[model samples]
Target chain A: MAFIQFLKPKNALEEGGRTAAPIQQDAGEPEKTCPNCHKPIPLSRLWSSYLVCPCGYHFRMNARQRITMIADKGSFLELFAGIVSDNPLQFPGYTEKLETVQNISGEAEAVVCGTAEIGGRKCCLFVMDPGFMMGSMGSAVGEKITALFEYAMQKRLPVVGFTVSGGARMQEGLLSLMQMAKTSAAVKRHSDAGLLYIAVFTDPATGGVTASFAMEADILLAEPGATIGFAGARVIEQTTKKALPKEFQKAEFVLQHGFVDTLAPRSTQKQLLTRLLNAH
Target chain B: MNQIPYAVVKLARDSQRPTGLDYIQNIFADFIELHGDRRYADDPAIVGGLARLQDRYVTVIAMEKGHTAKQRSCRNFGAPHPEGYRKALRLMKQAEKFGRPVICFVDTSGASCGIGAEERGQGQAIAENLMELSTLCVPVISILIGEGGSGGALALAVADRVWMLSNAVYSVISPEGCASILWKDSKKAEEAAACLKLTAGDALRLGIIERILPETELGEKPFYDRIRRALAEELEALEKDPDLVPKRYDRFRRIGQVKERT
Candidate 1:
């Protein structure tokens, strides 16, 4: 009897005929949301919507895509591509994860920074990628942002930092936090040069990123349905012990409550950018 | 989230304007605005206007965010970007040299963040302002009107009397970012907000602020009036009691003590 018990599988079903099964019965269908309205629309409609919702809510757009939408076909000249991230802390498994994410994302850091032309107007674009570990800012990210700032100053071009982030990168620890000081200093330098800087807040621009240069833009424009704020909704509710309004972190709510300059629909963002540049 | 001081300026305008123009319209009659850092261009974000408050002449510096789209662009949304901070420091030192008590209205989400601001040394600018503020020979008073986030708020915060309103928030970082870093989730920002303890009540309880001025029950009064009254009482009180400087200094020095083990 003891021998039989030792030979028995961990699960009664394992010993018998039962086999492992998937948790969800409907695994074939995954939810795809409309970028504009944030509604659970089918993938077919999402694709047809041009990445925007029928209601005109804009989905988060990365640097390259934003440039494509703004500039002539392939007008962007990527700069600072040589800069790559290093594992200074050498945290366990971090190097491997970094390499894996880098390879998968085809980028080292969250920001793809360089000088680009949108509608023939020269400007600097620093686009934050939310897909890359939720776009956490590390040393490379900070350096790239600083580089963009420097480039903007040297060229006397306006700066546009399209930001989306999950705050400071935990992997970098103090180094990530130091970026706040670093980026803040860089922004200051640019401001002293009397250059114009416009902050374009994409979906989910929260945390340390928002705390620094993102909030300091001469013109702070947010995408419709984009979340732009320093503190998250949950944090405020937890601290204040009160339920937040439905549109707590939504860009519309922030605009209504005086957090940003304007909420531009995705279709007109390029035009708005050009217009703001002209006004500046 | 902060109210401005249009009422006091209005009253002064009505009483002080020699020929015509209303107080709000002709603020210069009661208060003269000075500009420029002398080293560079004048920053419109920071308004350094010489004002007569309670019959006492004083230098008032307020971080002004624009009310309209054009204004927000002009004032950098009240962030006192690098140049703004520098302009403010210039104002502070000038006020000190003249022996005019410094009254600052802090309403920035934080310092301006731009490439130019970075090149101009945003941190150094803020640090210098903080250092200057800590050692001001004359009385310095600060009030948090809106979003006092991080060193931008701290730079102006070191003063004889620090006050905040009910709806204002002051913190190292906005509560949302704190949560995302700590909990690996931005959705749980509510947890971080509670943890920061950054509301006016918490600040007052911690002795970080001297007092909290309640909004009047006008139920119909303009926010500008509430702001003016709050700022006026503190300004007038400190003006009358010059000794409040040392007491304020001592009060500030006593904050953040830690016991050591032998």
Candidate 2:
């Protein structure tokens, strides 16, 4: 059996240039554009607001950057760092694609699962990096998430997961889709232990992930304008042949629909999370 | 066995096909119907209860498509509301708590897509079932009796062993829905069905389903008996296996990860 060397911890990050720095290529654009207002804003203003434009459009952030922004300085301890995918299906060009994304995004996997401190409250955190394969969940991603929930259960700690994905990794086929069931089960076991699980949905949280752990939270929160749903807007529109409301899949739309508990701005997420974790 | 996928899809959707209630009545004994998710109204589409499957007492959950027009409205034509999924999850958790095996009869075209259902957290409800069902320590067996569509079917389909009738069809989306979405023509449902690979045979080949029970021409008795025998064998095997949870977990993990190409 040939195993991909990328599965090794150091090898994945070394091949990817820098693991510590998150993907901020979008910030490098001379005039950071806000999708809502269609206005180019300064990079400094975007970063200061945690990538939420002044006009209220939420820009995407990578996993490491998310942790850095939320977790206290030097308080994040990464777990399941080396367990990367092995193209189990051996799908055509899958390994190459994974390598390319890893190198470009500077992340080992789409999701970063570990422990972090939020306002002195210890919690288990899993942040999905949309830069890498749209933060798709596959075997490696599933394994890391399951491991994190198990760890939380054993340690009797609260869990805080930030979901940002385009859905299951299609390249892995059924393996990727099955992660939905796998991760959800882990979340259930953790919940059964009477531990708190809070999930924060960010931009473009759809597909299998949205159906699973992303929605299996004791307290579900979302960024103000994040797109969250089962089927995409275009598919729903085509199937029903009715023009959808402008805010159809947005976080605020879902909140009004009672799917999410609340919608917070990206800037206040850490503060809100700290309070939720401490209270839980 | 050489039939096209669309024919199987059509057969699976045929109203003449024996539904979940029919199989449950024939296969199990001493059935007691359970209801309500405790958090919402009891959804009639999902019928669950405790029953004796031969000697093993198990929790039985079935998606009912109703026989009459009035019954169809009552059962929502087997399209479960969020409450139905919640009810199934509530019962499955009860079975797990009691160490009883779970048997589900999946016969839904899909989850209810109505506005009321969506407002009630339909996606979250289905997702909760999938997540909780995976970790249930007791063995779970799901039999696809008719149309197993999308996450609705998946909520009940995540089991240690997933069996499908020879004519059953399970897909991510209904053929008409898929056709309309992909080609902007619902009339291309046949082409969509052909491409979806939703037949029992295709599901088995794809590793999504465990086995396909052969359809006998001698009517429903023999078919139900064969399913009973298969269930007995699976339950007995799972009873002996001590690593039930991890074994169940690994069963799904190995799916869609083919080592060598055909």
Candidate 3:
């Protein structure tokens, strides 16, 4: 029960009793401008708010930060950290780019997978890193996710994933494309076993990922204002030669279109996920 | 002969090359064209139906890029919309019920990118196809007749056996698309093509495809005949296997396997 203290707060008081803190930014403190409200928010305030602005704008969070936010403290046991991408095709500049991204993102691959407890409920979890090549799915990402699902099926545990990808890693060529089928088949196997799988789409879950595991979940959730679509908006606009509707490809739009089950804002996502897991 | 990757790409996308409908018309007999996704309007880009593969009934689906300009427009240049994928899925499910083998001919630049396609959930459609096709009780054989573009091509290609035409090219993104994104110049497409390893030979080497159908007398009666015979023989062998679904899963499962880089 001691681990319960690390759980996300359900109310203002539980949030370190810091709800009464002034929203106004102090002069000379580092701040970030909110894209939605166009207001400067202090870095400390944003961190305290889970990187969400008071205007309800959800800023992109990296995989590690997300794991910390969603998983119980000390409960995340990482699996498949040794699996890293190799340029099997020997695509020019890909090796250099991967090395640079690995150093900058401090991640071996775009996706991090492991077992963890959410609100005391055990599950297999994967969170895609936006910092790592925009969280592209290549061989390593596919292999790790497939292995995780296979493991979860054997353990009879639910699987939760947060997806944010630019789609398949083009540097890996068709092998990248094949990952979609590989992961989808694994998901099918886990699903056929009657295990639970929930997918949470973060900003920009598009391309091959959108067409594969991102949409194959039993419960599909999206964060507010997340860009979730099969094709890039610019490409669609250029192809159709028409103006996109307001908020096109946003999570809200996807919900209206009946693709996503619900829109879970940052604040309520943990609780909603826990409740869903417990319900099943 | 080892043609340049870009040349293979051009050959695959050549307007004069035989398209999906051509293969269906030439290889199978008693072809009956089915229409519509039943959830929405029918998409001409993908044509699916029942046909006989030399004495046995099979469900045939293809991404038809019409030879003529008018036909191309009608087929949306073989780029399927969400409805097209749904229709293909519907036909596949029908095949499963009747215990007929499914044969798909994939030739698309990619899935259609437009307002309506997204509105109708293109990603969901493709994802559904991938999941369903993996576990489809009946054997599925997908032949890459031309361009196998990304998820669009993959939607119909989760099969027990996937074969590619010798000149066909399959890639995550078109070389031009890849070049524009990576090098910030589409003029680097030739270089990108070489680096992408999208040729049929590269696919065979990677084990992404099981066989490469030679293009000798390509688009001629003999070429079609050869493919027909291959399909019939392969289907006969596949129909005898009890582990079709699991083996299909493992076929894709073993692809991209790499050792842990400790």
- How would you encode candidate 1's per-residue C-alpha lDDT over A1-280 as one tens digit per residue? 0000012222211111112221222436543444234455444454455456566755445455566666656778888876666655343455676666666555566788877776667888888876566677767777778778878888889997788776766444334544555566567667768899988888777666775667767888888777665445554565447666667667887676555799877677788888888877
Deviation of model 1 at B22, angstroms: 46
Q: How would you encode candidate 3's per-residue C-alpha lDDT over B43-81 as one tens digit per residue?
A: 999999999999899999999999999999989999999
Residue A102, model 3: lDDT of 77
For every candidate in turn, the CA RMSD to the true structure comes to 17.1, 6.9, 6.3
lDDT of 3 at B70: 98
- Show where candidate 3 strays beyond 4 Å: A1-26, B1-3, B257-259
Residue B56 of model 2: what lDDT?
A: 84
Candidate 2, residue A210: the lDDT equals: 80
DockQ, candidate 1, comes to: 0.03
Top-DockQ structure, candidate number: 3
Model 2: per-residue lDDT, tens digit, A8-63? 23322221211223323565654454556766676667677777667777777778
Off by over 4 Å in 1: A1-48, B1-262
**Tens-digit per-residue lDDT, B200-247, candidate 2:** 876788788889888885236777788888898899999888998887
Please state the CAPRI-style docking class of candidate 1. Answer: incorrect
- Candidate 1 structure lDDT: 0.61
Candidate 3 per-residue C-alpha lDDT over A1-280 given as tens digits, one digit per residue, 9 for 90 to 100: 0000011222221221112233343577866667677777887888998988898988778788899999999999999899999999988877888877777677899899999999999999999987777788889999999999999999999999999887898888888899999999999999999999999999878998999998999999999999899988877877789999989999999999999999999999999999999999
